[model samples]
Target: MTEVTEAGVSKAGVDEAKAAMREIFPETPLQMNEHLSRRYGADIWLKREDLSPVRSYKIRGAFNFFRKAIAAGAKDRTFVCASAGNHAQGFAFVCRHFEVPGVVFMPVTTPQQKIDKTRMFGGKFITIRLIGDIFDQCYAAARKHVEETGGMMVPPFDDRDIIEGQATVAAEIVDQLPEGVIPDLVILPVGGGGLSSGTTGYLKDVVAPENFIFTEPEGAPSLKKSLLAGEPITLAKLDNFVDGAAVARIGDLNFAALKTFSADQVMLMPENAICVTITEMLNVEGVVLEPAGALSITVLEALGREKLAGKTVVCVVSGGNFDFERLPDVKERAMRYAGVKKYFILRLPQRPGALRDFLNLLGPDDDIARFEYLKKSARNFGSILIGIETANPENFAGLVERFETAGLGYEDITENEILANLVI
Candidate 1:
């Protein structure tokens, strides 16, 4: 591995980024979070990137990229990009700020809410191209457009300027802390490694944080895998539940700064566990965080109460580009993570008393969330899909015990992805 001596972004880069980005949007807040501090036994603070003009930190990178591009005699150029969420929105806003013509390509499946917000932000400065069902397809279409039209392409997170821009967040974090005060730990969300790589690069020389935890969706551990193998690797499949932080491969340049960290520092957070954090922040803190934004907080459970007790920690709340349409899915995942929901496929006899026998097994706190007869055998058997929700997760264990005692044939489908995709 080539050891790059952090010629990359840093505190100095943040100052440069700030001067350049001031034309776009002001710095986001790095505020103390009382609620989290009290719960985790730490002096916790939140870098509220979610409060930026675009409700994300993407604007910093986009602005810096555009500024550098324009300075290099590209003012007459049209900019293009592909993104379905916060990045695209930031690009549009930056295009509008510079009064430059830009085109944004997004997946066809992107929610209307995001599409509308992007349009509103860009106004007449940008054009929206809905091209493919998936991100890679849209990305290809955008690159082709840029190639054919002689326009500049603004990558979401891979560019040098983008990393420098994101490093500005670290500047805000340092400035917000009192003199002679440095956090013992810093938790950051890793998607394509732009934000994490940028922030860590900046902080490395200034402060040797006692610990650094990188939170990636379990479905996408690109950084962890890349560091383990000594090179970037593409994931064959990626679950988009944590859409904002789900990346198939960490960016080459971003990983250059990131590979210095050990694999243990990268924490893989479950998608469902993230939902719990999202809901908690929304309901308790009245802070609406998208899945990616909640990544740091969600991994707190793994830190264990003992390690976190009486320490100064900072968690970056990445973005708040959440679509309310996903609320049902988020709630369902939260319920499952909290151990209040389960799904099962029950094999039933054709006898009239079979349904009654199963009903008698459920505890008083158990409620049938879903029930459907999925299959039937002509004379003797049937297949039923059942979903149970309870006051607590332990209730399902008792329900399972009763099913076994009664000699019932059943399959727990709660964690079955293939079966879940078919019906759930």
Candidate 2:
């Protein structure tokens, strides 16, 4: 393995890679987001990697790896990669661009939309294999195929070449900014730490190390845990809600590049909090972001306006391959996180006019989104699972007060993960 120096990655190598990338596609935009700047009272710019051909910065790494390998006179014309999301699409697109044959292994559980997109990008240059039920299983299959066929394997984030490729994002940021204007902070979303590692590696040389803020999904804190442990540590369990950024283990190469940073510089964003940003961006700016893509922007709420006010910040919006079918779920999670929506179990007496009585307890703005009786045949009383959305969070308090006045027995299961998952 090549050693990652304390000096970080190569700036000249990244610049050269960026130059090669221009032959395939133009640099993604680095626009100052007026919506975010106004809301946070900061000069907030977004590096719109989401607008890339593959809809993510993953293409840079994939393209660079393949480009370098071909230039080095590798005999194997076939490449294999295992990915369920952005990386797969990026690899597929690059394979088509280079006119090289490639094999892509993806989890069978991956959504049809993603599968279609990957297939569309790869076209005749790639063959899609729907393998195991999870990413690990698919990755194993890809590795086995590579070993059997003596084909080159393009790892998602663990290789030095991939890291250098991703560093092009940082190079572009520096060039895109106005002369003499240095950003106070650069916020990056970490999955396996590839983007964060590469961006920070280059930015740390030009900007202060303290100016970089790394954001990871709260359910998947691979980089945060690695930083605290002083080495890489795999998580036992990870919620895949932020699918693009929910990596259980940080890549060894990527981590080596990032290990110098303090844990305080990393922020863990709640899955629901990210959903709020996704919904806000979609509704307000007409910008769609996958959960991982929203992490950098969502962490601004955690940092607060006081800390961000008058500062210039650059947030990398990593991907925009969001499935619109999940929009309702995203909105529900966002509303719940914002405290304007809740789920509860009500013990309603199984008597005539009981339902009508409960209806009167709701405030004018409070609307029942879901209501179902658990035990409809219960003689005296039955448990009713209810979901309510209100204009104001405080309206729930008044409604609960009315429920108490009516002597209705209820249990709030809004924050009860176990019960909410089971019943709600």
**Per-residue accuracy of model 1 over 343-384 as CA lDDT, tens digit each:** 898899999898998899999999999999998855698999
The lDDT values for all models are: 0.88, 0.91
The runs of at least 3 residues in candidate 2 whose Cα sits more than 4 Å from the true structure, single-residue gaps closed, are 1-8, 376-378
**All candidates: CA RMSD in angstroms?**
2.6, 1.9
Backbone collisions counted per model: 0, 0
Give model 2's TM-score versus the native structure: 0.97
Q: TM-score of each candidate?
A: 0.94, 0.97
Q: Candidate 1: TM-score? A: 0.94
Q: Which candidate leads in TM-score?
A: 2
